[model samples]
Target: MFNNVYPREKYLKKIRPFYDSDIIKVITGIRRCGKSFILKAIMNELIDRGIPKTQIIYIPLDRRGYKNIKTSEELETKIESMLGDDENYYLFIDEVQNVFGFESVIHAYAEEGYSIFLTGSNSYLLSDEISTKLTGRYLNFETFTLDFSEYLEMKRFFKKKIDQDIYVEFEEYILNGGFPKTIEFDDIQARQTYTRGIISEIFEKDVKTRKRISNVPVYERVQSFLLNNYSAPFSLSNLLECLEKEGYKTKATTVRGYIEDLKKAKIIYECNRFDLKSKKSLRREQKYYLSDLAIYFAMNTDNRLSYGPSLENMVYLYLASQDYQISIGKIGKLECDFITRNTSGDYAYIQVTYTMQGEDIKATERIKEREYRPFRKIRDGYPRYIVSLDRFRDQQEGVHHINAIDLFLGKEKI
Candidate 1:
C-alpha cells in the first residue's frame, strides 16, 4: 500500500536483521519524522510475507480511539481481546509512550510470545525504567527526517526535477529541509507553513507539555537562539549571555535545563568537542545542530547567516543517521566540523563548507588551508574529507575534497 511512499530502505534494512527476534523492535525519533509511517510500512511488509492481517494487532495510542486506554490494565485488556487462538502474533504499537505503564504491558506481551514493535517520539522511551524493564529483550532503531537521497526520491515520485545542475537540488534541500510532509508541498509558502506547524507541535507537545515548562516565552527564546546559532560552538554561559542581550532575563541553570529538554525531545542534537591530540572529550563549549534543517528555517525568517551552518548541520545529520559516533574535532585553536567513528573502529575527520567553486588564488588557498589544517594535524591513517558545494574533486596530501551533492546522493563515499 505504501510502495509509492518514500521507502526508508536504510532504516528498513536495519530492522530486517531482527525481524522475528525475541527482542522488541523500538523506533524512536522526533515528531512527524515518519515514525508512524514506518510502522505501517513494516506491517505491509509482513502482510506481503504471507502473514495474515488478523495476526497483526496495530494500535496507535495517539489516536482518539485509544486515548482512554491510559493504564497497563486497560492496554492488557485491549490486547487480550485482539489476540487469536494462534500462538504467534505481531504487535505494532505507535506512540506507546502515550499510555501509562506501557513498559509493563510490553513485558507482559513479550512473555506471551508476541513479536512487539513500538514507535515513540520522545527519548523517555529508552530511559532507565524502560531499559531496566526490557534489558536484553529490546533493540532500538533511531529514525530521523528524510535524508537528501530520500528527499530526491520524493521529488522523483512527483515527476519533479530541479535545474540540470545538481547544486540547485542541493540548495532546495538545504532551504526547505527533508521533512516528509514538507516534501509534498510545491509552493514555498505552503511548505514553510507546514514546517512551522511541525515545529509548533514539537514545542507544544514534546517540549512544553512533556517537560512541564512554565516559562514558555523563555523556552521559545532559547529555542530560537539555538536555531539561529546552529552548528556553532557555545557554552551554557554564552547562551545565557545571548538570551540576556535579547532582553530575556533567565538563569544559567534554567537555560541549561531548557536545552536539555530540547535534546530529550529530539528537536536538537548536541555534539561534544573531542580533543584530537589528547584523544579526550572537552567538558565545555559544545556545538548544537537541529534535528532537521527545516526547524532552523521555520524558526528564523532570515536565511542570510544560515547557509554555511546549514550545510554543516546537514552533514552532521547525515553522518549521525549512518550510525557514526560523531563529535566536533578540536586540535588546539583549529576545529573540524565532524570527527566520526564507525563500527569498524575507523575514524573520519570532515570539514563542511558552503562552496569552494570560485575565488582568487589567495582566497582559494586560504579556504583549502582552513578546511584541511585540522585533518593534517591527526597522525592516524583514517580518512580525512573536506565536503563542499564544489562539483569537482581533488585529493591533496591524503585529504579528499568531495562535492557535497555527491556525498548526499551517495555518489561518493566518505
Candidate 2:
C-alpha cells in the first residue's frame, strides 16, 4: 500500500525511541487518516532490519474471517496456528476492535516474548479495554494528516525550491486540509466530493455504530452545528434553543451526551477554559475543535475555514502532537488559544491568531499583558507564547511570538 509513497520517516523517528520496549506499539488516529499506513511502514522497517518473513505474524481483523472471532481465546488459537513453536515472533494486528477481548490476547502475547503492534481508527479500541489489560505495556502514537512541510515532501513537484509558490500552495492546503486521499488528488472539486463521501462513512461507522445513536437526524444536525461553529463557547441552552429553532426536538442531556461521546471517540475534541488564578479547570465555558478540518469542509457547504478558529485548531493539533494536556486559558476576559502542560510538571500558554493586524492588534497585545499579570499573582514561572501568521522576527511582547508554519515544523517558542 505504501508503494512509491514518501515514507513517513519523521513519525518513524518519533516511534524509534519505543522500539524493542516491552510496551505494545499502539498506533491510533481518526478514520482514513493513515494509521494503517504507519503500521505497514513499521513492517517495512523490520524487513529492512533483516527480520525474516517467517518470524512476523500480521493480521487485519477488519476482514470477514476475524469479524466473528471476537474472544482472546480465538486470537490465541489463530496465532498458534499461524506460527507453531515460534518462540520469538512479531505480531501485528490492524483494527483489532473487530475481535472483542483482544487486548487480553495482546497482553498474553506480550508475556510470551512476542512483540505486538496494534492499530485502530476508533479511540474505544484502546479506551478502557486495552488500557486496563495492557496497563504500562503500551506506547501510543497518533497519526494526523500531512503537515505543510510534509505535504511538500510528498509531492515531487517542489523538490529543490521552497518559496512564495509554496506559500500559495499552503493556502490551498488550509482550505482543503491535509488528508492523504485529498492530497493524492489535486482537483479541488474532487477533493471536496471525496471529503463529503468520507463524512458519510464516518457518520455510519463512528457516530452511528460507535456512538449507538438512535436519533440519527438529531445527531447529524448537532454535528453540523458544531462544525459550523468550530471554536466558540457553546452553552447547552444556546445549543438546545438553536436545535429547537431548527425544528428538531431533543433533550439537552441527549445533545450533550452525543457531543461528549463523539469527543471521547476522537471525532471532536473539547477544550475547557483554564483559570490561571484560582488555578482550576472550568467546564461551563469551553471551546471545541474537530479532529480533522475535513469534517468541517464536508459538513459545511461553504467550505471556508474561519481564520482565527482555524489557527486555534492548528495550535490544538500541535499541542496534542507534543503529548501535552491542553485547555483554553482565560485570564478575566482575555483568552489564550491553548494552555498545555508537559510531563515535566510545567505549563505554557499559547495564543493563536490568523493574522495579528488591524484592530486585532490591541486585543492580541492584551492577551500577553494578561498572561504576565496572572503568573505574577501566583509567582509561577510558566512560559507564554503567541502563535500567529504575522512576520514578526522580534515582537516586543514578554511572551514569545511564533509563526504558525514554524510551530507546525516543531519550532515552538517559549
Candidate 3:
C-alpha cells in the first residue's frame, strides 16, 4: 500500500534470501525510518514471486482496528479470521510489539507452518524471551534513515535532474539529514515541528510506555543531558551528577534505566569502548549516537555538528545498515570513530572527520596513527579506513581516505 522507496533497494539482495525461510524476519529500526515501507516492499516482492494475494496478510498494529487487541488470544482470533485455512500464509505485521503475548502468537504461527515477517520500531520489542521462544527460527534486518546516496535519489521528487557535484547534496544531506518523512517539510519551523513530533512519539512509545519511569522530570533531565552530549562518552554516575547539578533529583540506577529504555527503543545506540590491544570491551564509559541527526538538531539549539560530531552519527547509521557490529575503539586515550566486525571474521577501524585537510591534518593523522597502535599491539592487521568530507580520494600508508559521497554511494568499500 506504500509507494515511497528510498535508496535502500541495494539491501533487497541481503533481505530477499531470508524470505520464507521458516524464520520470523524481524525488521528493526527507529520509528518512521521506513520499517513499514520495507515490510510493504517485501510484501510486493512476495506477490511478484508468485505468492498469491489470497495467501498473504498484512496488519499494521498502530491502526485503529488492531489497537485494542493486546493479548495473544485476541491477535490469534484476528489473524485466524483473516487467514484462510486452505493455503500457506505470509503474515507481515508492523509494530508487532503492541500485541500482548506476541512471541507465543509468532511461535504458534511458525509451528502451524506459516511464514512470518514482523517489524517493530522499539529495539526491545523482541526480547530474550522472543529470541528463545523462536530460537533458530528468526533473522533480523535493521533499517535506518536515508544515507547521503539514498537522499540524493530521493531529491528527484523536487527536480527532474540532480546537481553534478554531490558535495552540494552532501552538505544539504548533512544539514537536513536522512529521515524520509521529514524531507516533506519545506520550512525551518515546519521541520522543527515535525521533528519535535517524532521525538515526542519516540519518548512516549519507546521510553514512557515500556519503562516504569514515573519521574518525568528525571527522565527529561537524563534525555537532555544525553542529547546534548551526542558522540561523547558518558557514564551513569556522570549523568546522575549532571542531573543533580541541573536541579533534578535522580540516581545512577534511574539514569541507567532511562538510557536502557532509549536503547530498547533503538532511539539512542551505545557503542562500548573496545580496547583494540586487548580486543575486549571496556566498561568505563560508552559513546552514544542518535538514529537520526535531524532529531538531534530538533532536540538541541546549539549546533554540535559544527564540532563534527554529526559526521560520527552519520557513520554509525550507515555502518548499522551494512550488518556490522559497531563499538567505539580505544587505544590509550585515543578513540576511533567506529570499530566494526565484518562477516568474514575480520575487523575494521574507521574514523570519520569533516575534512582531513589544513589544521585537521595533524589531528587526523594522530587519530589514524592512534588506531594503528592498538591493532599493532595485538598483531592484528584488519583494514583501517579514514572516511571524510575530503573532495579527493587518497591513500596514506596503508590507510584509505575516502570521500563521504563515495562511501554513501557504495562506491567505496573496506
Best by lDDT: 1
What lDDT is obtained when candidate 1 is compared to the true structure?
Answer: 0.83
Best by TM-score: 1
lDDT of 3 by residue, 224-259 (tens): 777778788877877777777878886677677888
Q: TM-score order of candidates, best first?
A: 1, 3, 2
Q: Is candidate 2 or candidate 3 better by lDDT?
A: 3
After superposition of all CA atoms, the RMSD between model 1 and the true structure is 1.8
The residue-by-residue lDDT of candidate 2 on 1-414, one tens digit each, is: 235445777678888776566579988877777777777788778887887777778888777676666787888898888895555788889887767778778887788768888888767777756787778888878777776667666665334333466557656767777677676675777888887787777667766776678687888788777878778887878888998998999998899888866775577778888787668999876888877776677666686557778777767876776678998777766666677888786888766667655467788676546444443433456776767777674365356778887777666644
Candidate 2 runs further than 4 Å off: 63-74, 157-164, 359-379, 411-414
Weakest lDDT window of 10 consecutive positions for candidate 3 = 370-379
- Count clashing pairs, candidate 1: 0
Give the CA lDDT, 0 to 100, for residue 262 in model 3.
77
Off by more than 4 A, model 3:
1-7, 157-164, 303-307, 359-379
Candidate 3 residue 360 C-alpha distance from true site, Å: 10
> Between prediction 1 and prediction 3, which has the larger lDDT?
1
Cα shift from native, residue 208, model 3 (Å): 1.5
Estimate every model's Cα lDDT from 0 to 1: 0.83, 0.73, 0.76
Q: Candidate 3 versus the native: TM-score?
A: 0.90
Estimate the TM-score of every prediction. Answer: 0.95, 0.88, 0.90
Give me candidate 1's TM-score against the actual structure. Answer: 0.95
